[model samples]
Target chain A: MLKKERQALIIKQINLHNKVLSSDLSLTLNVSEDTVRRDLHELAQENKIIKVHGGALSKSYNVTSQQSDTYAYEEKNIIALKTISLIKEGMTILTSGGTTMRAIARALPSNLKATFITMSPLIALELIEHPNLEVILLGGKLSNDSKISVGGEVVNRINEIKADLCILGINGLDFDGITDSDWEIVQVKKAIINASRVVIASTISEKLNSALRLKVCNLKEVDYLITELPSDSPTLLAFKEKVNHIL
Target chain B: MLKKERQALIIKQINLHNKVLSSDLSLTLNVSEDTVRRDLHELAQENKIIKVHGGALSKSYNVTSQQSDTYAYEEKNIIALKTISLIKEGMTILTSGGTTMRAIARALPSNLKATFITMSPLIALELIEHPNLEVILLGGKLSNDSKISVGGEVVNRINEIKADLCILGINGLDFDGITDSDWEIVQVKKAIINASRVVIASTISEKLNSALRLKVCNLKEVDYLITELPSDSPTLLAFKEKVNHIL
Candidate 1:
């Protein structure tokens, strides 16, 4: 099996049982114990799972096989709640793909009337319960790891869309600006950023001040910043100087 | 709690524990047993769960709380397996959304290289693990129950997309035509039929000949038909004259 598939299977197993034994995963996946351990270690590094001796436990209380989220999924969930409060009825939103974004999708009020133009298929599914919410999936080439449509088609499609607000999930954000590890995703983010009136970048405080391969935009380009941290915290204070708003 | 929210919670609880009692759900949700029983009854009507006296069991084995798809989920799964065999690597496919399509999405080979243009947000999530597959979600108004896109945007998008093949999930298919209960979905499927080089329809044999609200297209419009029934069985032989291909 491919490494991605194996990791996904491991995460699914953890979500189903809330914990997994390395030996069991090795047997079920038909892979080496060392491979299972390595996968566990990598997931731990991503903060997606808690590494335990001989096994791993889910990072959150109840993972629904959605690969949960990053570094304190519950904390990000709180931030997601705040993000939804910013949404006014009948507004158009441009949402980028990630676990944090999916949380926002989950927390959206079912009765709220809104239009969401999103690049993430996963976020679209998360938002499916809303009867009044209109979802426009920005179509294009798909990126393997990120699971978002990327590249030229997405960029071109975004050019034709103008949403009231844009909520982006970032890998890294620093003084240098918002950066992503993949160029294709960075291009698509640029389009999403360009198409919206208000662009808010959301992530856990743990990811702040980090830089990656390609820059999506400068901090000045981001209208607002959101994290689990208090808005007035020193962590956000640095970002407040670079951006117009923080939440 | 809203009826939808109540239903979602019941589904989640059922997924967490293989079975859940109505009394326990009434206690947990702070609703009356009557309300809980009503919710359970509604879900059971949607074919979402197996309703037993006093409680409910999961509709299928190991439902991941992604609303595990359709009546006779296992029977649809058999047809889904055969659908995958028709797909060639690197083909661009136009797919209509439903439980059967989701089963096909789940059964897809991880190594297969293909692009799927679909209207279902749920199906997109189901297809996310295929590293080589490109998923383009047709966006528009979200239908409350079906969870697929509809209206002008999806119709217009389909017009521009000429896929190599189109696979449609139907409410009913008989000599009259492939039918659906939703007018908006029928409009979108009409556009899909116009844009595809080859059009195929799949359903469980139990749903055959049960026509609903709208007529999507004539049986002559379908290039292939797939059912759980044996191709040479007396049951499937009825559809042989109308559809060119069967599996």
Candidate 2:
């Protein structure tokens, strides 16, 4: 195959599979791993894909480029559907910023009357058309990559509100606790933990064993942990043992 | 000339001059304004340039884009240099998010002692290595376009602190007041205005006489308005008349 054709094939594979290992692509394309790596680097430079630790992932899968709402659509939809089960009319809720939270915002039924206090611009935009829902955006310094607010101001504002429920989108969670990738994010999460009456974490199964740089709260702080997979999964069981509840 | 060459030439002209009139481009190119408009439209489609009310402006000149820091480097440097002059040792200062502010953050003297509070992740990242600076990042919803935090939580945090100075980057300013293009941004700016003892606005001359969707604070609320040009400039004079001070 021509060099352009092979590169195009690699891109197609990444788009199809969400991620591709360099070695795998090398073998598939009948090229050396070094050549595949070079192609991936060039493609990444073109913003066609993202170079991960050992491979390439579709840039579209990353939430920072576009609105976070566009990523993990199915997972977010399932998480949102599961999350809405915990909501009740007239309840005041605090939702954090993430693709999952954005999905929940979009999936919220218009008939469900509730007050939402959020630190996500995408959420505010999503909730703008909802007449029955009152959305209060927590203002602070913006993080361009995450499209979420983080800083002391966001934390202080979260502290002032007493929410019936807080639906947190976990960056990473292990048996020990909920963790965040950024130190600034931890500050906001800490405030959310202090203000909410019931803390609910909406995360995917993949994030169970992962831990990031900052620790927000212990698993004990979470009232419930919801994931798309079945409740009997080992990760869920481990989390259930540490936290108060699981969904 | 070929269509692509003509389009490239127009784009080059706009980048070279900063602004160009459609009629002038038409006359210079010996083509009708309608053809120039079509070429501009095509270039805009390819993200080569942006179509303004009258003619095209170089996308390279857009300060909000990912590579915006590269363009307008001289103007941003001057603004940063002037802005840093306002900072003093041990004073707590609030800075809004923008390429201009980011430049200011970069230009800050490493030995200067101050508590720098902001919602811009880029600024926070830049300040991490500053030994003498205490960086407090305000948390809230993040806006991807501007990479600034906004919303209630961020606002509440701002209200809790009384900063010595607040340095703001104006989106659009008019005879009436300072306006933001986004609704949530207005809330964030209002919080910033209320939290600081002195409000300083840093903007270019062209930003004046324009209004955006969200109103932050009126010119009267500002303690000082700083621009690149002298205070006697027509736009600055208009702004100076509405406010108590100019820098």
Best model number under DockQ: 1
For model 2, residues A1-247, the per-residue Cα lDDT tens digits are 4454466677779768999999898888899999999988877775667998789997768646456456667777888888899999999998888778878888889788988878765566566445577766665555646656677767767778899999999999987688887878788888887899999999877788898878888988899888887778765776666877777
Tell me the TM-score of each prediction against the true structure: 0.72, 0.49
CAPRI category for model 1: acceptable
Ten-residue region with minimum lDDT total, candidate 1 chain B: B60-69
Q: What are the clash counts of all predictions, listed in order?
A: 0, 29
* Per-prediction fnat: 0.50, 0.10
TM-score value, chain A, candidate 1: 0.74
Query: Any runs in candidate 1 off by more than 4 Å, and if so which?
Result: A1-65, B1-70
lDDT per residue for candidate 1 within A1-247, as digits (tens), equals 8999999988998889777888898899999999999889777756577777778876654334432354366778878987887899989999988888887898888889988888777787677667678777665555656777777877888899888999999888999899877778888889889999998888888879877667899999988888988899987887778899898
DockQ of 2: 0.10
Best by TM-score: 1
TM-score of chain A of each: 0.74, 0.71
TM-score of chain B of 1: 0.73
lDDT of 1 by residue, B55-123 (tens): 999866655664555668778888888888889999999998888888889889889999998887777
Query: How displaced is residue A185 in candidate 1, in Å?
Result: 1.6
Off by over 4 Å in 2: A1-92, A95-160, A169-198, A202-223, A227-247, B1-51, B54-74, B97-99, B106-112, B118-132, B136-162, B171-199, B209-225, B229-247
